[model samples]
Target: MGRYACVVRPSISLVVPVFNEEENLAHAVAVAGRALAEFTSQYEVILVDDASTDRTPEIIRGLTATDPHIRTLRHDRNQKLGGTLRDGFAAASMDLVLYMDADLPFDPREIGRAISAMEVTRADMIAAYRYDRTGEGLRRAIYSYVYNGIIGVLFGWPHRDINFAFKLMRREILEAVELRSEGSLISAELITKTKNLGFTVQQIGLDYFPRTRGRSTLSSLGVIGKIFRELIVLYPEMRHPRRRSPQPAVRPAEDRAPI
Candidate 1:
């Protein structure tokens, strides 16, 4: 009888978008690296620096030089979270692609569970919802409730956390969706579009923690207003009666390669 070997079939590419997150970059990289190591043998971490006017780019470059599994992309100007994520997704080359905040609000270890769910349920995407959101301010809490409600009402998908950063999905799903939001509403846009495109989604609960380093950009009223405006403008185009069918964007094969 021949001995059988278990091969790790699914590799992961994790994207961490950093904007003025110099303080958290090292810790985030370490924790995320350890988490990825626990699950897969083949993985890469792509750090996207969105033109931060701080030492973020320098730190990312140092980390990338030290770790061959770590790669980076930089924007000439601050493009916000949406643009960073788009760039990271486009540069990912693996069976699975995952992204989360550089602040490490959610535990990176939960990534293993997400990967397991993806394999078991065969879901196209798995998003993490914050179970304990007390660390976030009351106003932010209220905004999240209202925003999620609005998304549910408008898009008809009752996802718990539309803006949570811990999203894991197959590479094909990223290839299938044409994401355009360049602001805070990118998370909502991604989830909404994924559902509209007939992709299966799974949600898991994870604990949330307050950032120990830099200030959060999410609590501002300006951001809330922008999200409202985006929702209003995108509602009509996204509400087509027959939009449940998949409408994947076509792109050149080389465009999907990692940078």
Candidate 2:
């Protein structure tokens, strides 16, 4: 923590999306809360539960009662990653918003470094890329590499990791853009729109930690199918996104003759 003593410590809303994460939610929130307290006193952890059928809801109730900094949002039914994040981001009311997985894919203490990076770079968003992901297994590593390369080529926005679950952004960035993906493509959608809208985005490298509790499902066939479906439907809109405000219309050529 001493190394992060210079962190700017902006008020942050940590948005975690969980579904059937009874094994990880409680411990994850507690750990994240402790890490957040290290740098900033003004912070809140919003756990958006996508109608988990396990004991997760019970655990969330217990956590909310025990931790004042913890709050939660519930969905009547599962909404996958994108919808869950959209609701969570909408609920965030802080200067900064951080999106991480309930499984705690990376060290929460690294959050301070991200804040410091944001401050140093003056970027509107700080997206983290895994320094090394071979820990997750070779298959996942290959999948991620191919996915990132394809995204970079298609979107013309090359990034180290577009779908990694570590994105720190300013509240204004969320307010300025409308995110519409209901699946894994949401991350790509977010980064693309942020860049398209003329916001500075910076990336930092962090040690990756694969989930040790519960099964990993984001790479399932169904989830990957949904990602492609959303990408196809949203491609045009993302490429030619409407500006937040209408640009000044150029006067007719004759009207500018005196210039």
Candidate 3:
């Protein structure tokens, strides 16, 4: 008698980094959860709370209590967006890992499209670009154009939306690259590193929506300056190639606060 082998379907881990987004948390999770469910039943949503001073933590506790697939990871102190993302990536446990903003600017359902693209083309990473970016001022627009241009010229990869929040990548790519940025520049760092490592990459378009509940945290001039400074420091590393390292172990959700 021949024995049958179990074929494992691809699973996904959705990482959402939350900071003082109490107003949007419940709705974001609901929408994103429904979107993920449409694609694969084997998935997990990891919410990383960066020590929000508001009622964000309490809201997360309430949401996680009802859903076993929803897990919460808390930072004792507030870390910036980059730190929160690093933790989220480390906590992800599925074959594919995706991270997006908590404000839900892009349609969550697009995640299914991204996963399909990844599978069809066998690409290692899928970078999302916004078609009509709403709710952004002229200053932000100019800054984004200039920043993306600089990255293109420096890295020789002309990806227009380097800082957009929707990124879906294979687990092996994350394991092979080393990420150091702990600010807004983390997005750029991840892309640059992936390109450097010769990973297959593809781009997809997403429709942007205006945020209704919370304001962006990285709009301050100080934050922008820090991102530029980090980019300057990362130039030398990007120019040189290093041996790919083994994938780091997925860190179990730390400070698993009782819901």
The TM-score-based order of candidates, best leading, equals 2, 3, 1
Model 1, range 32-140, lDDT digits (tens) per residue? 8887877765899999988889888889888988899998999998887778899999999987898888999887878777776776666778998999777777877
Q: Write the per-residue lDDT of candidate 3 for residues 1-259, one digit (tens) a residue.
A: 0121112235789999899998898999999888777666488999999999999998999999988889889999877878888888988888788888899988888877787677666678898998875458787788888889998998887998988888998776677778788888898888888888777789999898868888787879988988988888887886665435654553332321110
Report the candidate with higher TM-score, 2 versus 3. 2
Q: Give the TM-score of candidate 2.
A: 0.92
Clashes of each: 0, 0, 0
lDDT of each: 0.79, 0.87, 0.80
The residue pairs in collision within model 1 are none
Ten-residue region with minimum lDDT total, candidate 2: 250-259
Per-candidate TM-scores read: 0.88, 0.92, 0.89
CA deviation > 4 Å runs, candidate 2 = 243-259
The prediction achieving the highest TM-score against the true structure is 2
Whole-model lDDT, model 2: 0.87
Report residue 124 deviation for candidate 1 (angstroms).
0.8
- Please report the candidate that would top lDDT against the real structure: 2
